[model samples]
Structures are given as structure tokens and as C-alpha cells.
Target: MYARKPVIVLLGLAVCGGLGCAQPPACREGQVATPVSAQRHPVAGHHLRAHAHNDYEHERPLFDALDHRFYSVEADIFLNGGKLAVSHRNLPWDSKRSLEELYLEPLQARVDATGSVHGDGVPFTLWIDLKEGGREIVDTLHAVLEKYPMLTRVDGDEVLPGPVTVVLTGDDKAKRDLVTRHSQRRAVRDSNDYSPEDPPADSAWGYYALRWGDYLDASSTGQLDASQRARLACIIENAHAQGRKVRFFDAPDHPDAWRVALEFGVDFLGTDDLRSLDTFLDGAP
Candidate 1:
């Protein structure tokens, strides 16, 4: 017998025996259908803003961090009898480095030559940790800043125009209060180590900085003490609520502190080894 052959049939039925197929709505003339959701492009992740603390004390000066694209740089300034000198510690011989020669002038030249902040398009922050007590330093800084409009300011909620961000650091509570009362200068507070009542009255003058004790230790498995950690968290939250950013210094030279700061989403992380920190921040294994 011959092999049997199968047959296929096609059917186009608008309505079945007991049911009808539903048809999609037709668009009106010259009209398009509405989409459920609009297409969205991806946004870039926030770039890490790194600062070189006490940059002038380094063997190579500001070039290392500037070359590495740090977003902020700090210089500790001590007002001598007549001039603003850069130094981490007050010493006679170290007084040779003036704020103009070691930092301001060179920084001005670099900004002019590159037409960039920290060699980037956006303006970089310059934190001036004042080690002096006289009004002369504050006046000098004000005058110097007049020449650089791009400096950053720390008003409670007031936005001031500038590129370089100047922060006054020291123990002169009287001078700090005076500046806070009169000028647009910013002040630094110890977040991890300071008392709860150390913040300024205006709140804008309350820029908190983290100290060494704020982080967990390698041997401790990144576990900060309960009270200290809680204080740090509260400081970060409170500062953020009041339109302030928290910066940390004197942190451990390990990844634990860095990770903790990152976890808490602190604003600025001050590191001596910018390259290492940058690498770690990039998620290097």
C-alpha cells in the first residue's frame, strides 16, 4: 500500500460558534497611540570628590592630587606676624612657605593655565584650615578670595558664588563666632569627636568633620563603638537635613573607615593617599 498523506486546512473566523474575538482599538486619523511608559536614558553615577588634606606639606606639593583629579584641596594656614604661611605645625623654619607662594599663587596660575578647577571642568574646593588667631588672617583670606570668584562658601542656606571653598579651622572660638556673626566664611566641627552642643548658632556655620575614632578597626571587623557610631550617624543625618555636608579626617589608613564613610554617604573623605583611596573607591578587588 502507498503511504498516506496528511492535509492541513486554514480557517479565518471572525466569530466562533459561541464566542467572538476582540479587536484592538483603531487609531483616529493622524493620531498616535499613547505609550504606557516613556523611554528614559541612564544617568551617570556621582563622581567621587576627593580632597588632599594639607597638600602643601607633601614632597611634590599640589601636583600629585591635582594630576590625579582630586575635587578638593586643603592647606593649613597660620597667620604669622604679617603674612599667611602654610604649615601643618607652627615652626619658624617652615614659615618660608607662604599662602601665596606655596598655594594661592601656584593655584591661581594653574587655574589660569588650564582654565579648569583641579584640572577639571567643574570648580574644585580649596579648604583653608586656619591655624592662626588674629583677625588679619581672616581679612587676608577675604581679600585673597576676592581675586578668585570661584571659591566655595559655607552659608547656612545662602548660596554664595565662588569656585574655591575656604574653610577656617582652629580652636579660636571667639574669632570663629565673630566670623560667623559677620562674614560668609565656613567653619569646621568635629563630628565623631565633638560634643553635641558644638554646632554654631546659624547652622550654616556648622560643617562637621569626622575624626580618627569615627571608624571601625581592621582587627575589630569594621565595628565602631556603639555610641561613637550612633553619634556619627546622627551628625551625618542632622547635617544633611540642615543643608550641610560632613567631611572626615584623621581616619584610619585602611579600607574599613573608608567603607564606613561610603556606607554612611559622607560628603567628603580626606585622605593622605589619594591614589590608594581612589583605587579603593573604584571597587578594586
Candidate 2:
């Protein structure tokens, strides 16, 4: 698996207009596109809800997370010379790392090889954080994603679960445009701005990524007091009841935090320490 060659996307002229050049057909308002289910291609493997935060920073990007059997992974990207490059910053050197080469194609290859990323029917998430927002960037991403049908898709308001689910993060406008502009797409949006009072999960906003400090007041000891625990549990329950998977990022990246998140039924536990998290989850009850 490690021996697979990279598939780089050659830069092309980015034309922007109505429907934004995404090749996938858009459904009319109130229409539903075809449904694709991941269960249809089920294979068997231990699928963990671990999320590799800033996964592109790792030595192997998506592969490292998959090696650890992590079901979720995140990558930050920016538009570089008409191509989407994976990086947290707009460093010129980062342009060499195309999103397609680093993450998309490898995931496509995995889906083809194992029927699904893990063959366990548990949806894998590829979180793409857009460093900047614009029609060109959003259009380019949708255009690129149109090539991969392995992604979980949105047909009107319905979700067609596929082997992998691509969630757009970072720029709020770009994420919204992805859903509003296109009626059919291979990706959904990830909202960190969600509140307990917010409306139920729509087809576009699939996950809630909360900042730990924003909701929980934990000390350096990593212990959650009774009130903090209550708050955390309330937030998780509220999000789950609305049909949105929850993830807490910018949290203490240690066993203490991980334990609390697991105990509270937090859906995707964010961590940069992939191997440690894998071992921890394996040893966990």
C-alpha cells in the first residue's frame, strides 16, 4: 500500500459562472439524486472513531491515519496556481503537495482495493479545511471532487453514504456555497459554529466541530468537574439528537481528554498522536 505512486493533477483554466463548473449534475430544487450506500461494498475491519487532526502534517498524510485504522482525518488546503494544495499555511513549497495526490487518489485507491476504506461499512471522513474562501476555490474543489464517486454525496437534502465522506471546513462561505450552488455533490460541510439552540442537522452541515475551551472549563489536570461534565454531556446529547456527529478539536491532546470524550460518547476524538490514540483506543473498554 505504501508503494502506490502519486497522481498529480495538472493545473487548468478555472472558469467560474453558474453552477460553478462542477461536473456533477445538480438536482433541481426539491429533487433527489441517486443514492449510493457504503454498506453495499462492506468488507470487515476494526473501524475506530479516531480523527487525525492536521493529518497532512504527518509523514504519510492519509495513509498514516488509515494504518492506525482511524475513521476520520483532516487536511487544510489553499488554492495555489489554480490547483488545490494541502497545507495549513500558504507556503510556496506546499504547492507541490496537491490535495489529489496526497489525499484524494490514495483514498480512491483504498476504496477500490478493500471495497471501502476499512470495509467495515463505517463511514470514513476526509475533512478538507479551506484556508481561503472564494468562488474559484469552491468551484475548483467541487470540480476536483466530481472525479471521485467514493465520497458520500448530497442529493438535494438527502445523503448518499459512500465509502468516504468529504467534509468542508474553515471558510464558512465556501462551505455554504458548496451546498447552495450545487444540488448534487460529493462533499458536505463541517460547522464549528453550531450551538445547542441551532436548527437540526441539514444535508449540508454534517458534523459539529467544537472547541474544547469554548464549552468545557477544564484545568491543567484534565479533570472535568461535575458542571463541566454536565455541560459536555448536554452538548453531545444535543448534537446527537439533531443527527450531527460531534468532534472537539483544540482540546488537550492527552489520554485524560481522550477518556472524557470517549466516556461522553463524543463521535470523533481529535488527536495528532495517531499511534498513541490507536493504542489507547485498542486498550480501551
Candidate 3:
């Protein structure tokens, strides 16, 4: 029992460390020495929001990126029956990992846990890429969102019941347009077929999410082909003209894509590996 006592104490310390506890400050008598300044963590600005595509499929789920302090995360959603399920495909949607359970719930917990805000002012963006078609999913999501007041439309900038900023992503431009027209919520155009000219007058597009199919392969880097690049540049310029940002995804998950995206002045580069993207943005060469 005597030897076992030390083992128990060590185990407790390990558990504490895993839960993000810091060591206690040393002191002398009743007075303590001046404490060192807390190290300032880097702020992820409009550079690249780390995206965990189909995060629910990962063995560890969203916790891995959250534990590493990822600024943004992505979860694909599909409408199965009346529930908003979290999955890449509609055929095998898991009831256990609903959109609320896998994405919104954990995210809400994080915002509650951190109490951190953008610029200590803006709400954190939760990018939801929809996989299935129909107004049913949108309605279901809207209903779920209504329950959580912290989430508000970015246009209003009001503090809702939650601190998450929800952005919808989908391939169906017409459907997305219909949702935006009826509701006041914000949505992004994630299609290669659509252009700025066709954008709605009161475009709810706060950001443009480009996929892997949208880019062309360069010698050693990923880029939009000549015509595609020109068109994208124009779209981005026009989008910015309307106070919107541009984001790209499905590109190489390495320094190559990061370098190109930065050079092109993209607002966000989506990646599955948050740590790598974070490091690259921090000037990893």
C-alpha cells in the first residue's frame, strides 16, 4: 500500500495535465515573487480557418482539433428523415452523430469553455457544408439553430444564445439562393458553375468556399487554371467589393497550397490538419 500511494499521486498529475491544468506557482512565506507574464497565444486572423472535413468520421472526432486550439472546424451534414445527421453521404447517416450532437453541441461547449471571441468581439464561425438536397435540411437546421440563441446572423452582429457564427455550404446555388431569399441567415456559394454576375442583389454570401475541383494543378503548386484563375480573381474582387471574404478548400494540405493561397490574398485556406496550417501561417519554411 505504501508503494501504491506514490503511483496514485503520479496518475493524478497525468490526468490533470491531460485536462489542461497548469502547475501551481511557488511561494515563500506569505509573500510570492512577481509572476512571469503569460505567453500570448497567436490570433488566427483572416488567414486560414482550419477545416476538419467530415470530422465525425475521424477516430477521435472534433476533440482532436479542439484540443489543439483550432480556430475553425468543418462538419458535413445530410438530412435523413426529420433529423439533421452528420455524415458525408446520405445513405449511411448515423443517428448517434446528429449535426447538433457532433458539431453544434461540442462547439457550443467549447465556446462556453473558452469564453474566447474573435477580436474578443466577433463570434466564431461554424462552417456547415450540406451534403443532401431539399428545403427539409435547411428547415431542420433553422429549427435547431432557433433553440440556440447564442448563434445569430452575421449581418445583425447581435449576441445570440450561443457564440457560433453559422455559414451554410452546398453545391446547389439555386437552393441556397432560395434559403437566403426567405431567411435572414448568411450562406456561402460553394459552386464552380456560379459567378459574381449571377449573385443576388442582397447576396447573403459572406464568403466563397472553393473546392478541390475548382483548382488546376500547376508544376509544383495547386492553382486555378489561367481562365479559372482570372475568373476567380474577378469573383473575389467583386465579392470583396460587397464586403465579403473568399475561402478555398480541397487543395493540397501542405505548404504548397498555403503559399499559393497567401500569395493570392485569399481570406481563408481550409485544411484537415489544423496544426500544420497553423504552423505554416506562423512562417514555417
Residue 35 in model 3: lDDT: 19
Q: Specify the poorest-scoring 10-residue window by lDDT in model 3.
A: 1-10
Order by lDDT, highest first: 2, 1, 3
For candidate 3, write residues 2-66 as lDDT tens digits: 01111112521211223443222112123322212112234544332455555666666777655
Estimate the overall C-alpha local distance difference test score of candidate 1.
0.54
Which model, 2 or 3, shows the larger TM-score?
A: 2
Error of 3 at 235 (Å): 4.4
lDDT of 3: 0.54
Instruction: Give a tens-digit lDDT track for model 2, residues 104-222.
Output: 89889888988788765666889999989999999999999999989988899998989889988888889889888998999888787656566788888878877665555565535
Top lDDT model? 2
Output candidate 2 Cα RMSD.
14.8
List, residue by residue over 108-224, the lDDT tens digit for candidate 1: 777677765544556656666776565666677666655654455546556564445555555455336545554455332332334333444343354555554322212332435
Which candidate achieves the best TM-score against the true structure?
2
Clashes of each: 9, 1, 5
